[model samples]
Target chain A: MDYGDSPEEGAFRDRLRRWLTEDRSWSSASSTDDEYWTRQASWHTALFEAGFFALAWPKKWGGQELHHTFEVIVDEELARAGAPPKPSLGYLIQGISRFGSEELCDRFIPGLISGRDRWRQGFSEPDAGSDLASLQTTAVLDGDEYVIEGHKIWTSYSDVAEWCLLLARTDPDVPKHRGLSVFAIPMNQSGIEQRPLRMINGVSNEFGQVTFDGARVTAENLIGEPGQGWALAMTIVAFERQPAELGYVARYAKTVSELEGDVRSDPDSTRREIAEHIAWAHVQSEMLRLHVCRRLSERLDDPDGGVHGSIDKLLMTWTEQSVGQAARHAAGSATSQAGGDSRLGTYLYSRSQSVMGGTSQIQKNIIATRVLGLPSN
Target chain B: MDTRLSSEQQALVDVARRLTERLGPDGVVSLDDDDRVARLDQATTEAGWRRLRDDDGDGRPLASGVEAGIVASALGQALGDTALFGPLLAADLLRRVGIDAPGAFTVALVPELSSLAVADAGRLPAAVAVDALGATSALALLPDDGGFALAAVPIAGTERSFDLTRWVSSIPAGTELEEIAGSRTLTGDDILEVEAFALSLASADLVGIMRGALELTVDYAKSRQQFETPIGAFQAVQHLLAEAKTLLEGSISVSQHASWAVDALDAGEAREAAAVAKAYCARAAIEVCEVAVQVHGGYGNTWECMAHVYLRRALLSVSLFGDDGVQLAFLAARRMGV
Candidate 1:
């Protein structure tokens, strides 16, 4: 049950912690929305160059091929040191590593991981909430090129990304799960237009729609097998709760730092609840490490279908929501308003975590039908 | 830096689990009945657990190679006691770490199970020793010459404590101070050591108890149905069960964390880690038991119901070994460096 990091892993985590804490970009600097995003990309690029990004991918794909511990060490250290997260950077590295081809990897993986380019998700259409499979965005295959024309809403950092991991229908004849194809949509392409959709979660900085009208692109931008986008998606998001997601590293440290914050002025209920929630979150992290350690020790490379993994996901998503709720509650009514440091934004972002990666409802369905072997609806 | 458990230590946990199963589970259910209370009745003194720990060399711990088993055995035997495992494990660890107690006599007030004196004075026979009401019968303040005697008192109202497989006795203020070879008083260094031990034990017990409650409720939800299909098939009930599983799983995490923390005492972060773990376990255990009962329907509320056993036992644990309030103070204070 000992889930402690190895000496080397510990050393790496300390190094990351020291770097993140010492770096003014993540620590002392308070930048405008534009400055923050651009600077974050630069910082991420630095990390990518350091071989600390996309650690689990094969070396051939510009990854270090290190153990999951390497990733955990980085995430945990960054989180504990109060380093601002590089969401776009994380997404780009992992996306390219998993779904990009040899050509794509050759062109993007090294630079993307080494923090050269920013990435955004072009998954959600305005009408697609939980019904993502019903995305109306269409991509017509042409001679050695694809004509893409559609609108994707809630596509985070659409305007800022150098590339977009867009999911489109190339074969609508197949079922929703099989008809889709994922492409490394170039955000800088001529026909593509990004419009920021400001929300309560976004800081008036764009988490908007990507309109691809007559967007022309070479077939090379396609990621994974065409028509297997959903499966590829499941494969990627399946790693959401895995150690690769920084469940090993960042999430735990985030809780600890939050616990370390100045929350004493809040109500007793708020303070106690925050403390309890942090502890619970810490527990969730420990469980993740235990499950991961046991699996790694036994060399058990089970897929996400295993009961243990589901249990980990269930615990994580639930606690994520709970902690988010606690943060909101602890802040009182003002937390939801436009003012005050974006507790509301974080709360909103966290609410969608369960829904975005996998909703609690969907997760339970998986646990009952697949993990517990109970019949489904 | 090595937070990884060695294979041998991992095996030690397995054996501990096995032994706990053998010792009559120290779970909520064990704390649930007349049988538990009756078993702890002073009538069983000669054959009871106090004899096992306080026994002469005739006991198993003194035997070579059996010491590891003793750690597991103490955990198993004190399943209901909740407070003994810490001190017992600490004593074992002290030997393992080769750190001598430096004295032949000192008393450990299982904090949760026993009370203590604010000031140390001479010995004299005092009136009566409180039994910590029986959560721990390790030792109590008593009076002698100028100090106090150690007398054992039976815990009141706690006969109903879940997992009543063990016994508790108060040692009056001034009971004759027997200088055992390794009797280390609850002193400065020993306090942290024992605190860690106690928290770890309670956390582990919560994990086992929580696992049991979840199983029971899941079974009941499946067997007892309302809308044609088993209620467990319903999303709402499934959600309820999911919460229990989440709580149980969380309990396992923190509980195991505390145990592992104890194993790595020099980490500097160990005590704070243990406190956090224990505090979370207290809340999770309570929630698990309460929800487990809710899931169990009417059967869970019965006087003889096992669910109540776990519930009551979990409640008792909340206040012991540094209650949630105590821990919150310790943790928040420590984090603030106050």
Candidate 2:
């Protein structure tokens, strides 16, 4: 068993580190949420141009066709350099690559990979947050076009995305899961309206409540067979659940470092309790990092997707919450008293870690039922 | 990097598991089965499991740390009552100091049992020998000029440990210790190497204990029925087990990496990695074992139930080198310089 990077992986990591150090243009100096997101987009484009984005995708589609370890390396370096996070478009890419036709893949993948065309996933709705299959969105066949009508809540980056991967019900009479289908709908049309949702962190551009009145997509834009949406959605979320793909370990490392700084700068904060909290925070982060590495290693041996995604999601939630609490403790009054401080923002954002993507409760239920084969009722 | 065990390592695990399951004590009553214990001990000795870290012709060990960890984990899983870790650790220390003395030797720990006992002026301090079983003496570190030397002190007496599966003994204060005549003085790096190996093995044992306890509880939950249905069918019970399983999986990951790091990384880095693993595994094992007991209900608190055995074993491992608190403090000082 080997934990250190292989020779090739070490070379790739060194090269990526060198590139990050040399090119500082992608570093964001923005103050406002709008400017931050704009810089984030620019950063995404910069990473794509540097051949570091979409690393695990097929080489034929503008990806590097490298191991997932390379992507993890990119994340570690980006976090170490304090660069903007790589765009979380792996789920969309997986949805397309696995379920999309050649024509659809040819049309959408390259643009997504190049960061020229931004996209948002329309999975959650007001009523279907965790029970996503119960979504009320409808996509009726109208000649060669599918007229989409739905409201997607918590739609990340919806305001800036040119396209949305929308899931809607195609047959109301069938089962909730079987009646759904995925569509690549254009978000620029007049039929779609995006209202930005201001998060607790006071970030408006990060999430949006998008309302689709009568968005139209060509029948050819359909992701898979009409009834294949449930399977496709599951596949996408499984990829989304991967912590390595999200660069969460690096993100946690950065937070822990910041917390360490906070504790060091304040002599009064050297209390044993505070030190232990920070130490545990560091331990949790390392645990998550090693756990993700083992998962990535297992993927190399057998790439089959399984319910292990739920395990990863649960562990990530634990680590994030732990680090967030430590940061809050270290920051003390500064977190609440100081305005526009990233520490306060980060502490608040960590509250949403267990709620977003999938609620901790739901993830546990998935593990209990699917992974452990426990009875649902 | 590959984290999966090699086929040979996998086979070693299989052999260890089979041996323990066949001869290991099954219940509290079986703990008194002297015949069974002897057979198990003989099997482990014949298999050369304790000599995994013994020196090859060169300075390197006969097997990697991962192989040693695999056997350690198996022992913990079956609650195997033998002296594998003690002998293995003793061998590791002797090999690091370039000594060839081999027998039923374990390492002597400080009075707190938090670290190896450091002898002074050719005399052994009052110390504890863990997993001493049939061992007559334990190795200790001796101060030599600016470096450390290896010495062996006779075990003065035995004490009943909380972990019934292993033996704990003590050394008298000011006991004369025999320093290996030809053994070379060891550097700080050698100490760290031994430390890394100890922590890795302890972490792996915790991982196995957690898994064993969880598996026992999970099986009970499946078979034990209440309110006209199996308890496992309840979401509360299922969620508890699921969370336990999740923690166990994470422990396995970190523990595996720590074991691999023992030989793969530099001494300092390997010790850091092992500390991280121990901290995580120590806390996690306690929680997982508690969950196991909780899920087992009234039976869990009784002596007949195997859950308490796992908890007892985990408690010893947690404090063997240092618990999570100790590790966290060490890490905070090292990483954050706080």
- Assess the local accuracy of residue B330 in candidate 1 as a C-alpha lDDT between 0 and 100: 71
DockQ values, each candidate: 0.23, 0.69
Q: List the residue pairs that clash in candidate 2.
A: none
Which TM-score value belongs to model 2?
A: 0.97
* Overall local distance difference test of candidate 1: 0.55
- What TM-score would candidate 1 get against the native? 0.77
lDDT of 1 by residue, A1-377 (tens): 34566787777777776666555555422122444554666666667665667776678766777665465556555665656543434434555566767677788776566656666777778887668898888888899988898888877655667877788889888888788988876778688877776654555454677789898767888887788788766665555544445342354446445644645443244455456554444444545544444444432233233444455666666556655664565456675566745444446656655665557677766666565544444
Per-residue lDDT of A197 in model 2: 90
For residues A104-128, could you state the per-residue lDDT of candidate 2 as single tens digits?
A: 8988999999989989899999999
Q: Per-residue lDDT for B228-272 in model 1, tens only? A: 788788877777677667666555555555666654554346666
